[model samples]
Target: MDLDAYVAAHLAEWRRLDELSRRRRLSGPESDELVERYQQVATHLSVVRTSAPDATLVAYLSTLLARARNRATGARTGTWRGVQRFFVDRFPGALYRLRWWWVGTLAANVVVTGVMIAWLLGHPAVEQSLLSPAEVDQLVSHDFEDYYSEYAASHFAAQVWVNNAWVAALCIALGVLGLPVIWLLFQNVANLAIIGSIMIRHDHGAHFFGLILPHGLLELTAVFVAGGTGLKLFWSWVEPGELTRTQSLAREGRTAGTIALGLIAVLLVSGIIEAFVTPSPLPTWARVSIGLIAEAVFFAYVFVLGRSAFGRGQTGDLDAALLEDRVATQA
Candidate 1:
């Protein structure tokens, strides 16, 4: 292609489109001309990109296209329909894409928690080092159970929700540091292990499981997802693949934002169970069943629904068509 001659031939039309796009009012013919020229300039952009690859030309066409598109579509806010699209397409798709990462995080936590429990159980001295006989007996006997009931259910739910959400937020907010995520996960697992070991050592293992399982399943899953997504964000900077570092981080960070919001709902469910369900007088089987059902629904939401959304080309990021000159950002 003779780039100079092509630009010479098309400059007048491009200017006309630019002028019509900039003008406050356009006659019907001019309006029609805007759309027609928009398409023509768009086609020229594609051809130039393939054949001549001029940065300035592509950017000009991209901006022109964007203005025309916005003018055509008009401005919109968070309408009900937009909110519905976000949850259905973006939120779940983000969670599903990051499933393997968080699943691995879940597995690692389980191993660490189990190991800590086994070690604590085996080493009686370790328990003694932390708590005296009287304290240990009190914990196993009443205090642990009482901790859940001492406050009103609603109050306790709010407290638990805030605390758990804070932990999840930390895992995400400090993801760029990477090590903070590991530390947060370790601290959470360590605390759980310590409490579990104390409960088991005093032969209240069954009671502990009965009390915890009703809420722990979904609660811990949310935490794992946060941590996993955070670590993935860190990895984005480390290994950006084909994207520039900034682009990769931008993409993953946006996705992480989706996970963060989705997990709020997930954590809310667990919080409700922890407050009302876990401490209920209902049968242990019934309580645990509720937890299991909630957990199953979450998994299905991410995998089944999220997979379908992803397959439909939902990447949980801003629409590429809405972006200006996406190709210009290429590394």
Candidate 2:
């Protein structure tokens, strides 16, 4: 192929694309022309790469196409509207669509925790084996309660937020494996069961509920959401249905990202409650009520905002334009 001759033939179209991309405003016809030129230049770049393999020409066309893409898509990165749309539409839409996964997770964990608590209460020997009498006394009397107030409130909230975020991230990050997510969730509830059992066995059941319920309600829910979303991702590849395995996994993985990002704020709220409200001087009823309200508000957000977004055909995935350029598939 004559590289110079090919460049000569398409140089005007490439230059036109550059000019359109640089313009602040484009007319109706100009916008259509810009898209047309972008596609042509993209094809030209593909040809140059495949046939001629001209490094300099490929670099220029690549940059030109990138600029044209940004201009054509309006490049919404880091914008307030983009953030708003994420929370209002994408995040909740994902939550609503995948509600059963997380909801089932939440229920199963609750049942397992409850059974473990019961078993521990009935089998006192197990508790004794895990913790000596003195250790159990300390946990029930001081350690459990002081854990909340041991750190300064603001510092504790930030610390808890980061830790919880890491855990949730792991759930999504390791979701593809299928077993790591369950292990994480199991370890989480097992710890809860052990503590609750010891506290209740020692006649401090009221104290246990008072401290934990204040934040545990929403905190555990966030964990469950993460666990469920991870499991869903695993299932995407396992049972991809009509879509190809790659497409199903990609769709679920992207939605998992949305849930992971959204869970940061959710976990932060729980952290704040855990740090401040759990150790506050307020009555147990009031603290528990605050936690209940937070939990309620989260559900309403999922059911209302998420439902609406899903009804509008939002799938929490990137827009079609952002996902891929409209390139012609050449044989």
Candidate 3:
């Protein structure tokens, strides 16, 4: 093909694309026309690359393609499809990748809590020092158990959801500092340990477990995930591997943010269970079993569904091409 003739033939279309790209405001017809012209120029650019490979033409088309791409992307509106992808792929994928971090945190926290409970149970004097005799008596006799039934279920569920979500958010937001994540988790574990010790010493260990297990299992798991994700974000820069520290932190931060949103739902479920199931008239076994079942479902979701998504290279982040510095990451 004669290069001159080819250029001349499509010169009008190229000019049209340039004009449309430069326009400040577009009518409906002009917007449609711009898209059409953009597609045509892309095809023209492809043909020039293969058939002619002229440097000048190639450069011009490349610039035009980029402009068109930005315009097209900018014009597109957000959709529910994006939200669906977030939950179906991004959220689960992030959860799976960070499972080890959160799981480890969870294990350590549980051990710490159990140790504290045991120590307090065995040493009445130690427990007495932590709270006054009258305070301990009040908690053991009423405050602990009545915590579940003090408010209406719906109100309690909303309250619990917001409070737990806030804690999870704090773990993620303050995760960059490293020590704060640990401190926040320590606060949580301390509460559970104190409550458990008091209840068990009063011969109400069964009641404590009964009230907690229904919501605590899943609820606590969500908290663990948040702490784990936060700590991982902190480490991303500390041990950035092949990536630059900036790149590593950016990637992990995006994933951690996604985990935060996902945990909102998990916490909400636990809140519902705490409000409805924990305080229900159901037998202790039945209540605890419900909690176990809910926890099992979450595990299956992460290990099975989440693992699959992660294996497929889903990182629970926006595409790298969307970010300026992510075009060619090292690791």
Candidate 4:
């Protein structure tokens, strides 16, 4: 078909495509297809328009080509804006609504800790069964008191902080795989259970509390935050709310990522305390006081500070609309 004639005929469809592209609600494959189609049509039109013998005809074709290009550009820009809005504005709002999940996760942590304490009171042999020979040897020979004293003396707090922060980040990041987060939570809980059991078995459970509680509060809370991050992603896969499973997962994934990053910072501070301050042979009262303070700080951050720090506020049903738009656009 002649270039000018084809452009005239397909102008309406091209305009529609341009509008859709600008909206950027389309999937990657759909957007790519639309861009390809636009490029192909433009190329063909360009050839026909340039070959026109009449100057007026050539000028008219050029104008049409410019319009098509402008529309395509506008569509691309709109799509980017939509995506930014989804990430920066929409996702955090959705996370804020999921406050119940965070509370449940914290409750779960307390339950797990209580279970460990109960198991320690009930079973003594289970501790030995759970630990490998090497771990037992390390526990016995390490003189944790002296080791922690030396750690407090050394300026290695920053290094400990970085290492733990990385672990928390990894736990959250890998949680995106769904099952990995479950595995992480199980491993962490099991380790704590065994450690608590072993300490009590040795008649040092009270002593262990004195030694570990100072920092354990922060460290364990950070773990819970990491678990919460993983849980959010896993829930997205399991229950996508108003969105299809895939769409929900994608939307939740972005919010989960931000939560994971914040968890990392919490873990880092916890690690510094655990490494340098917790294991020392501090008096029971001192340890208890520190642990209580740490717990208070953690609660404050999770409940009061997090909302502002994360920029959470009422999104007024925007998330639902976004999901609907995504589904409709995909269809």
Candidate 5:
């Protein structure tokens, strides 16, 4: 048969195979066979369209590609069940082999936090240098309890939430450049130092715990996740192992994207508390309790609940098949 006819006969099969692949039910051998067939058919059809420029062939292939793309996107965002399966079941097993990423990120956070604490203890002027006069004034003059209460009531809460969300997103997105990870680490460390210094300078060292602990825990954790993601990207470039830098980066990017999404959720919660809940006229004990609870929830989601919600055993076999098929199709 001619290329056009051959392509026409297989297009329906490709669509059907794509659908089955997404359902996470295909076995490994069957998946590999389908992927091979899909790639062969797609390549031959692509060449045929390129050589003859038949409008019918072009339209058919275009529609097929578009459908495949939509299916992939839908699989990612279609429902809570799918998303949970993807994260818990599919991602962890595929990506958790990169243990160095966890180690490097933890080490970076420790170094940065320690340096910031040391600087605050030794250099009082550094705080004023880092913070603007207005920021310093606001930190000093406002009763944090009252300020937090007012912030919670105002539109400021939404703004802070959106802003922090964007920051977390940017940290992950910009990791594509590699240097942004270092910049993020330094920026966060400097901010921590400035805040620590300001509190100590005002003789509110003890009060600082009540002021920041509520939201700071989650907010800082989100920042750390972002930093880790960026470091992973950079590490791919520095140590590509068997893969090319480009390939390594792409692999790491997929995992980092997942981490970034989880962090965005954390930032949203942190922003709510920082803007509205943290600053309430609640007692110190109440604030401490709430903060501890929030921190516990965040950790539980990341380490415990997140595992159960999105574990590898749930979707690994099917996801691996689909991923292989997609890769083959692209090739």
Candidate 6:
């Protein structure tokens, strides 16, 4: 196709469509013309994409067509219904679809933390290298417990929420590179191992588990979910399978965003547990049970609601109509 000649032939019509789309109001005949021009330009875009494959021209026509489409249909805004659908369908569906990724992450981190704890216990000298005897004594007896109750519950909850949310966000945001997500997860588990090992070695194992399990179970799960989602996003482009790299990335990226949003609520619940339940006068069994129940509820949300949504073909992606049209081409 002679790109210049083709553009010259359609340039006038494209300009006309642009004008109609830009207008605040259109007469009946002009509305009809706008619809007609929209279809024509859409076809032109397809042709240019398939034959000429000019990036600049394809972008121009795509933008022009989008404007015309919005003008023709009128714009829409989010409603309560949309928000309801997101939680009921999109969020759960995403969680279901990406279950293995995060679940594996959670399992692996647990194992690594356990091994690290065992190694540290086996090698007592390692502890002295990290902290002095005075600091260790302070941490084991006071600092560890005081950290939770030092602040008001509400203030601590907010602080925990913000900090955890930032960590989760970083895992997802830097997930595309792959290594960063792994590193983040490692840092998380390493800290746990270090603290857990120290507590156990110093005969504070019960206290440590009592304090940690109350909130750590759910909180760490949320973090693992973010890490797994990030790893999946990285893999999407690396091994796209049937879809083009761009399509796969876009699809996974959208799902990751949904997961990110959903995790806010998850992390909030954990934050509340940590701030209130962890530091409360409740017994260890009671507090740990509460954590267990929260973790169970999360799993049920994924296995029940998420599985059902996925069965109904919800992919946690944008609705098809809302996604931009892609020109099909052979690899």
lDDT of 5 at 82: 77
Model 2: lDDT to the true structure: 0.91
Query: Per-residue error at 26 for model 1, in Å?
Result: 12
Instruction: Tell me the tens digit of each residue's lDDT in model 1 across 1-331.
Output: 9999999999998888888888877788887887788777777887888888999987888888888867644533246777787889988888888889999999999999999999989998988999999999899988888888888999999889889989899999889779999999999999899989999888899999999888999999999999999999999999999988988998899888888887888888899899999889999999999999999998999899999998888877766645434543332
Model 4 over residues 1-331: C-alpha lDDT tens digits? 4646866776675665555546536677776766565554455445544454456644543454455445445554478786565445543454455567656776886788678878666875665576776776567446545556664444566666676677667666786676776677777777677666666666677766777678777776666666676677777778788878987777667666656555555666666666656765666788678777877876754445545534655331333322322332231
Which regions in candidate 6 have their CA more than 4 angstroms from the true location? Answer: 1-41, 52-60, 68-77, 327-331
Off by over 4 Å in 5: 1-77, 83-107, 125-138, 143-147, 150-154, 306-318, 321-325, 329-331
Backbone clashes in each candidate structure, one number apiece? 0, 0, 0, 1, 7, 0
Error of 5 at 256 (Å): 2.5
> How close is every model to the real structure, measured as TM-score?
0.80, 0.88, 0.79, 0.60, 0.71, 0.85
Report the alpha-carbon TM-score of model 4 versus the true structure. 0.60
Best TM-score among the predictions, by candidate number: 2
Lowest summed lDDT across 10 adjacent residues in model 4 is found at: 322-331
lDDT for each of the candidates? Answer: 0.86, 0.91, 0.87, 0.61, 0.64, 0.91
Error of 4 at 261 (Å): 1.9
lDDT of 5 by residue, 1-331 (tens): 3665766677677667566445555577765655555555456556655566577765665555554544444545578997666556544443344334544665677677767777677876777676777877678667454556664355777777787777777777887777876787678777666666677677776677788888877777677667667766777778999987876776777777666665556677788788766777788778778878997876564556445534535312244434443343332
Arranged by TM-score with the best first, the candidates are: 2, 6, 1, 3, 5, 4
Which residue pairs collide, candidate 2?
A: none
Evaluated against the true structure, the overall lDDT of model 3 is 0.87
Q: Is candidate 5 or candidate 6 better by lDDT?
A: 6
Cα lDDT tens digits, model 2, 64-139, are 9889889987757668998999999999999999999999999999999999999999999999899998998889
